[model samples]
Target: MKNHRKGHLINKGNAPYVLLAPTILIFVLFMIYPIIRSLYLSFFELKSGCYQFVGLHNYIVLFHDRTFYKSLFNTVVYLVIQVPVMILLALAIAVLIEEKFLRGKAFFRTSVFLPSITALVAYALVFKVLLNGDHGLINYVIELFGAKGVNWFYGEWSARIAIIMAITWRWTGYNMIILLAGIQSIPDSLQEAARIDGATARQRFVYITVPMVKQIILFCTITSTIGTLQLFDEPFILTSGGPNNATITMGEYLYDNGFRYLKFGYASAIGYVMTIIIFLLSALQFKATAKGDTD
Candidate 1:
């Protein structure tokens, strides 16, 4: 009887593991296996079903690749400019929408958020038409002032501006919604007490509101940074990386290498490099934000 009871307890303890077996197997097969396979492929020369071991060759080639460097530079520029602008704009919108005295709050919120819900392809097509140099709506407006329409996608700087505009239009509202949720999570009594203490609106925002939302802001910053690092669609669709590879991003380069050029190994290496850079950048951002919070 004692042995039978012990055996029963052992079986009971193993039951949960048995239940989780399918999920664990699926995760390993889908996620873990792909990552490991890609990493291995990155160290080789892929040809047909066979690979030749060429350790570090892909990475070495990446260093000499001018297009890769250009893509890296463009990606950095996008992150530096787009991330701050989007986050700041989102914060402003969230604060305004969350104000108790604000009327038509639903209308404002919905209107602002509508762009985020719009299909990416639809928005890209609209932007392409709007930014067209000859007869685009934006240039048509500029032509009213007797100015020649700018070649938005033809020039390097103009191409970058167009890409930034597209990114901001699509993502700012999503960030705002995240921030609004954070703002709503803050207790109303704190703001009421601050008001009762004769705190100015600006003072309340800087002191009470900002501090409470720092974590959410940090979360947004990290996520936005990762997204910017992997940004592909806007540049690919909007400018095709421009007339001179001006707006090529890491993600674009990866796609070009893996699919267009059929250099899967090189693409895998680029992907891994991008993964590392994104991880490092995100870690640094989180640390800096945490330190600012303490200060």
Candidate 2:
């Protein structure tokens, strides 16, 4: 009876693990293994499909690579410009959509949010055709207004502008949804209290609404930073990182190195460097958020 009871207890304890075993096994096999393997590969060079240990050589070379610096600069430009604009725009749209005076709220929300659900490739392809230098819809529309048709693909700044516009269009709705949720979570009583204290609408928004949703804003900002840093799809499809390498981001550089040049080791190094950058940026944001909260 004692042995039987012990086995029964053991079986009960093992049930959860048995149920979770498949998921756990899959995670280890795919996510964990790939990350570990990538780190291992980062330290070595591949030659003739064989690994040759290079210690820190790949990383050392990365530090001095002009293309890597150019890629980094391009990513930083996107992070600085596109991210803030998108975040603020999303926040504005979220705030506007939540107002009681807004007519046909459901329709407005759906119309705005529709882009978020659109496929990236589809969106990029559409933008590519729409922004084409010659005989494009946007230029055609401009011509309708009796204005000269400016070719988006022909100018460096225009290409960057077009890429930013595409990303902003595609992602603003998604971020707006996030911020809207954050806004809804805030209690109306607080806003009412601020109003009763003779605070203006703008004051309530700045003092009451913003602080309440600061965490969500930080989350969006950090995610946007990482996303912008890794931006590939928009530039890839739209400009191919061109009008000159003006749009060439780190992800594009990583792809070119890994696939085009077949410099797997160098690419691995670039990947790890980007991983470190993302980690550091996330940490900095968290630290800043904490400091802001304390203050």
Best by TM-score: 2
Please give, for residues 150-192, the per-residue lDDT of candidate 1 as tens digits.
Answer: 9999999899999999999999999999999999999999999
C-alpha displacement of 32 in model 2, angstroms?
Answer: 1.0
**Stretch of 10 with least lDDT, candidate 1:** 44-53
RMSD of each: 2.6, 1.8
Alpha-carbon TM-score of each model against the true structure: 0.91, 0.93
Model 1 Cα shift for residue 125 (angstroms): 1.8
lDDT of 2 at 53: 99
True-structure lDDT of candidate 1: 0.93
Across 121-174, the per-residue lDDT of candidate 2 in tens digits comes to: 999999999887688899899999999987787787788889889999998888
Identify the leading candidate in terms of lDDT. Answer: 1
Instruction: Report, for all candidates in order, the number of backbone clashes.
Output: 0, 0
